[model samples]
Target: MSLNSTPQSVRVHIGLFGKRNAGKSSVVNAITNQEASIVSNIAGTTTDPVLRPIEILPIGPCVLIDTAGLDDIGELGKLRINKSLDVLDKTDIALLIVDSTIGIEKEDLSLIKKFNDKKIPHILILNKIDKVSDKDILLSKSKKLVKCPIICISALNRIGIAELKQCIIDNIKEENTDFRLVSDFIDENDFIVLVIPIDKAAPKGRLILPQQQVIRDILDTGAMAIITKETTLKETLANLNSKPTLIITDSQAFEQVSKDTPIDIPLTSFSILFARQKGDLSELVKGAYSINNLKDGDKILIAEGCTHHRQKDDIGTYKIPKWLKERTKKDLIFEFTSGITFTEDVAKYSLIIHCGACMMNRAAMVSRIEKAKELNVPIVNYGILIAYLKGVLDRSLEPIKAKELLSVD
Candidate 1:
């Protein structure tokens, strides 16, 4: 990942969805103007979701996800279909492609229902319009069945691709573009101190995603960021002539940083900042309260947004679980999941502990949090849970004092 490039987590996730042989791949290729997804006459050519990040006109950075057909057959096909549908969790805008020659089918209608159920803004794309006679008839039937914008295009000939792109731009909600990591509250020219630990677990010679993103957000706001390791945090503060606005540190170094920083100065962690930016801060804080209710034999799910090489004491796999067990003093059953693989069957787990989600988009993180809420399962992220364990949950959250959402008192 280049520092100049947009991170996938911050880009608008546009998903192309439809049944097998519905020209989903064709729509993707046509819209991107590149061979982003393999297009073929064979059904289910796209078995897994292919995500390509590109800058679209007016919309800026966007991720187009081409998924497998929903109407697949056989046992293996079922799994492929499941994988394709999982893309819905992170999809900001859905592009439902229908073969105009065949018209809308049961599968397409079912997909529309899903789009409505998820409340995801979607556009119905009628592909292969050149092949179909009486395009108006197909359009009439589709408009009657699906209550959304419809556009006809011949992906093979690149006809109406421009209109489709315009439709996508039109459906982009304001909420999708208004989110900021930490720029909304901070002012320009303010000095922000970032304590980044360069340990073995840290990526060699580069900062982590959350750290990089926070610095970028600060710089975008015209604020200055003073970067330092935990070992030099005290000296960095002493050398500064003016008081910094706030101090943000990694969750792993929360205790030591808290001890070094003054009580009057605001302090927080990168993970906690992401809780408000990427995930649900209020819901996560409530979940942190549930940590005290853990009993023996309870099943807990520890989920990380991205997968990485594990050290002897990885934060997600080792430190978090160890701290949780020691704090609760219970024989809890732990289930771990990393990357984009989040178990939909969350009822089996008493609690869901998620990472900071620097690698995931807000849509994906919100989807997971919503799922847990629907099942009445408490879900907290790594930073919040760590603060709870360190007995500084309230102090760690002081930087973002969202009193309406968090009842830290």
Candidate 2:
């Protein structure tokens, strides 16, 4: 993680998926102009998905993911196939590599269908074109098979590589642009206070990624960022010449911070801010209402984006469940998942509560939300759930332009 480099989560995630010995790894190495993955003649050389972050002319900072072959065999091969499919959840764009000599196979068609189902923009790459004699016939057959931008290239000889890169850039540009994090909330010279709690869960001697990113965004907007712990929030406010424009706190300290902060000043939590940045704010806010509908034996899923060393009073595993039990007075069943593992069987749970996805990209978060929507299961995040439990959900969301999302009593 370099200070000058962009984070992998924020970069455009480009996944390369195809069958065994389709030259997927070779294509990745060609595009990056580096040996990003193992290039072996043996089948299933890439057992796991490999992520390489690089900067190109049109795409800027992008993460290139080379995944295992789709046509792998046996039990271990099935596991590899599953892993390759999982990469689709975070892929903003895809490259389906086909060995020109072998032409398009059934497995390749299946990959195209998945790309269409996920609505992920993809390019069908005809790799090792030099090995094929009748290029025109192969091109014609491929066009009829999959209706996507198809490019012919020789990964070993570097033929058509430049055009392939430009095609990728064009598709990514057409997909979507970057969204604002906090610039929309503050104007130039406005003062924004961030109430960060210094507890055991807090990383030693430094702020977390969300806090750092918020401060950077505030500075980028020419606004002032006043950072203080929840313990010193009152004194910090007292010493200020005038009221701060807004106050943002950690979700764990929402109850105390909401009490100390004035009613007129807008207040929110870091998780809420991030929900708007990386996920759907309104949808998550609406999901908070599910808390009231929880039955005695209902099941809840607590999902975290990153896996960190847990402290005894960890907020996700301990505090949130305890708070929900007390607030709803239900003997709820809790299931937990951390890192990139998200269950596809979303209907089993009555509700899904996710952590602020600071470690995940927007594509990944949106994929999770879409899965929940398809299963008709309500999903909320840590901040909104905490605010709802604390009976200050509306007030905490006042700082954002999503007031219409709050439920009317």
Candidate 3:
């Protein structure tokens, strides 16, 4: 990924959803002004969700997800429908395409209900308006059926395309604002220390996403970022004229970094910072307390945002589970999921341990957290859990001192 381009995890996610042959794909192509999705007269042409990253005039960078039709039939159709619904978890805004001639169907209504339940911003689109004789009457009927902003458009003929684009921009602006990764914590000329350990698990020649993003944020704030490994931390600190404003380390080195750094200096981890950036930080801290309540044979879910070959001492596959069992003194059952397979039945798990989610967008991470909350399951990320296990979780959170961190166990 280029430094100039926006990451997928930070982009606004817009999902297109409707029944089979409602022109969902057509609408996507029309709005993007590109053949982003395959359009066909046959039903269920889109088997899975197709994502297109583009730059809009007002919205900046956004991801347009074209999902499978909700009204698909048979066993395969059921699977496709489930996939379409799964897209809802990552959608910041949704577009419900309704065939003007046929009006809204039961499936479309059910989809709208889902958007309401998820609290997702949405626009009801009456497509194929060219085929209808009375477009105003059709749009008025749509407004009466669904309590959302309704727009009439002919996707094929490009009618009302500009208006729909503006609607998307307006709704997105209403729903979101800019947030910083680490710039808010420091000011111009402030010195920040970042401890990054290069072990076998670390990538060969590149810094991880979180570290790169943090450094970029610091530079953007006109602050000086000093990078060092855990072994050289003391030497690096001694060379600085004044004590650093903050110290950020990889979660694996929290114990040593906490000991080497002075008591007055604030300390934290990349994952902790990302927890605040990508998801609910307080919720994850509360979930960390669940570790102390685990029993032997309790099922724990270990989820990673990206997949890679597991080394002998892999953090997720080996290190975390081993350390967790040792800390709890229990024979815990562990299950794993990677990439886009997070939408599952989480009720069976005692707790969920997620990655820092540098590769995932904010909407996707929040959706998973929301799912855990709905199922009455506790969730924590890799850094928080590691800090808790190392007996330095509280110390690592000293910088933020959020209300939830104040009561952490």
The whole-model lDDT of each prediction reads 0.88, 0.88, 0.88
**lDDT tens per residue, model 1, 1-409:** 4423778888899999998888988887887798878878888788888978777767778888988889999999899888888988999999999888888899989988988898899999998899988988888888888789999999999999989888988998767665577787689999999999988888888888899889989999999999999999999999999999889999998889989999988888899999988867989999999988889999999999999888879887889889989989999899999998999689999999999998898889999999999999999999988888887788878767733345543
Clashes of each: 0, 0, 1
In candidate 2 the C-alpha lDDT for residue 294 amounts to 92
Best by TM-score: 1
Q: After aligning candidate 3 to the native by TM-score, how far in Å is the CA of 347 from where it should be?
A: 2.0
Worst 10 residues of 2 by lDDT: 400-409
C-alpha lDDT of residue 263 in model 1? 92
**Candidate 2 structure quality by residue, lDDT tens digits, 163-201:** 998898888743334645777768999999999988877
Off by over 4 Å in 3: 1-5, 173-179, 402-409
- The residue pairs in collision within model 3 are 9-361
Q: Candidate 3 at residue 160, lDDT?
A: 91
Residue lDDT tens for model 3, 102-191: 998888889899999988899989899999998878777777889988888999999999899888887873334344677877889999
TM-scores for every predicted model: 0.95, 0.94, 0.94
